[model samples]
Target: MSEKATRNFIDAYEETRAALPGVGGWLARRRESALDSFRETGLPHRRLEDWKYTDLRQTLEKAAFAPAPAHEGAVVLPDRRSASAFAAIDRHVLIFVNGRYRVDLSQAARLPKGVELHALADVVHEQWAKDLVERRFDDTRQAENIVDLNTALMSDGACLRIRKGVKLDKPLHLLFFSADPGASHTRNLILLENEAEATILETHVGEVASFADVVTDVAIGDGARLNHVKLQDEASDAVHLATLRARLSADAKLSSFTLTLGCGVSRSQSFVLFSGEGAEANIDGAYALRNKQHADQFCVMDHAVPACTSHTLFKGVLDGESEGVFQGKVIVRPHAQKSDGRQMTHALLLSRDAAMNAKPELEIYADDVQCAHGSTVGELSKEAIFYLRSRGIPEAEARRLLVLAFLDEALDLTPHDLARDALKLLVSEWFGEAVL
Candidate 1:
């Protein structure tokens, strides 16, 4: 909104670029060029089709951009000692702090044979960077705003490649955090080779005033199955913008679920490309917001090949002055004959001040494909509340029970155990109770 904020954005990016290791080198030079593009493009406006329902100018007012500096001393991760898909798994885990990797306090388990995980900074100068971008990049048929911004300034993230025919028994956890009171950007890539199968769990959390910017690109090979779970819980004063792009091959399956129960302002975009025929992609997500907080979940599912299938379910609950936005696009290319896509976006509003914006699109160039989308916003059914009251339950408890039931599907879909509990408590706290 103000000229100062725009300048602050540029200044913040410059500051981070200067502080990055190996300055003036090849990697830095490339990043500098990206920074220039980022400045020129800046943040997207409402004119963009995907961002029409959600506004970015609000973030301009909420943000005070600066690259978080190196956090000194030791910082402990929150303990969630519970049985989880993460608990049963034993793959290498990478952790980051203020956009920088923290080798300690991470779970770098012994991975199954023939798997390579790189902490981006350690390998950026090598040929792998070029190989990665060229072979696995996801412009998603179009460069969305978040992807462009993330590409321009991302400092550090993880890159993993699984050998052909290898099956990783444990899921890899890529944990990222930003404790500094500034903007933090992270970029990550995962490549599953032909006949390879792997699962990845990524967590994004911040306990300090900051902004989280992230981009994830995944290449799923033929016959590969990639299960991805992303968790978002940040300080209440934080801003988060993220994009996830996945390319699926013939007979490959990709299941992705993201949870959102934190941040003052947050938005997540998923761009799924069903490149190979018979590929299946599942998108399931939930968001709980209260106390004037806002969250947006947007998606684009493209069936570029014949016989691809996709399914999406997004649910949200808004309380107090909170608001939620959902925009979904399902595109079927002319060649993508017999494609099957189903999508639904819904939100429950608890207060009169609460609001939800839902947009579902179907762009079909083929006549044989089947695509359907729907959206809804409403309050709890009085009959259900009355039935609970008739059963002698208190009004408050009745409300809480119904809210919990509304969110069960999404939470149950959460692949990680601790993350599911963490999100449940976040929802509980939004109502007037302690998480304990």
Candidate 2:
């Protein structure tokens, strides 16, 4: 039998290729090559070692989503708190509705002298953006087999580039709202030159059953620093798939964090490569899921040079028969001496039917490296809940307190102070709704 979903995507690409960016240039050729790769592998399924727990091929076949249309009329933000969780933060904002940039709804002004920001179509021809898009990672292909489809169909996204020794005045926020049902593909590119520093925030929200596919490519130069924070809260019937790839040069630093609270089926993938010595990458995330939702978080960090450091931590809460998964690996190359890497994943189940799957692995080829990985899946401590209740708190309040405390450890890892508080508030509200 033929793969119906895969064939649909192939046909969609042929139908929309003319309207996409880079009509006859390098990106057009890149898209053709990417589509060829997608045809060869189809979609990732249980047969793939990395996708043993999440069968994307099966799920997409069932959804059978078509291309989403551009939301033209007044785009009203979703009523949920997740849609405006970071509105109070002082930052430059860019809004995209139904995968198309909405400049009228965005507020970006007075960028630093060396900073550049544009939509995907505006900067598609730039050499820097092209380099970031075409860069390849290590020999890990199975995990990102679905990325080929995104490359071929990605319609619009944010493009940010910071010059050498420059620092952004405030955080740049990218907000994506799915107003109507259907599917959309978005690609984001970020480039930081030597000694440059910037912070970025990403938010994904939807109101109806939709399919969201996104890819972000990052390149950090020597002595540069980049901090990224992402919030995902789509409709309960939505499907979200996102992949992030980052390359760090000598003495560069990257701190990325994500919080997932919505969606019926979602997967977040990250691939980080340490290309020069003395680089550091910290990848961490926390999630709260309920209903029959399924969320998967996968990360792989490659230490290709000497004296690099990397850390990974993921914690989540599952309830109401929901399921959570965390799969991570840290690889230290043979010549990558003095590399220090650590990975840990922890989960708390709030109900009997809730399930958690965790796999943290370390592959060290250097003799002088220090690497460790650990995972823990447990329930809220009954004793702790009892103690809270004994302090005059109601049973519902007690449970909420304990859940917040359990997730606090991971939330503290968020690099931004104000954003951290915003996330905490949203998670607390989510818990309150769960109790009702």
| TM-scores of the models, in the order given | 0.90, 0.98
Model 2 Cα shift for residue 176 (angstroms): 0.5
Error of 1 at 219 (Å): 0.8
Residue 432 Cα positional deviation in candidate 2, in Å, after optimal superposition: 1.0
lDDT of 1 by residue, 71-167 (tens): 7568765442211224444556777888777777667667778787777776666564544443333435334434545655677788787888898
Best model number under lDDT:
2
- The parts of candidate 2 lying over 4 Å away from their true place are none
Query: Looking at model 2, how many pairs of residues clash?
Result: 0
Number of the top candidate by TM-score? 2
Native-to-model Cα distance after best TM-score fit, residue 261 in candidate 1, in Å:
0.3
Q: What local distance difference test score does each model get?
A: 0.75, 0.91
Off by over 4 Å in 1: 1-6, 18-29, 78-92, 125-128, 131-145, 415-436
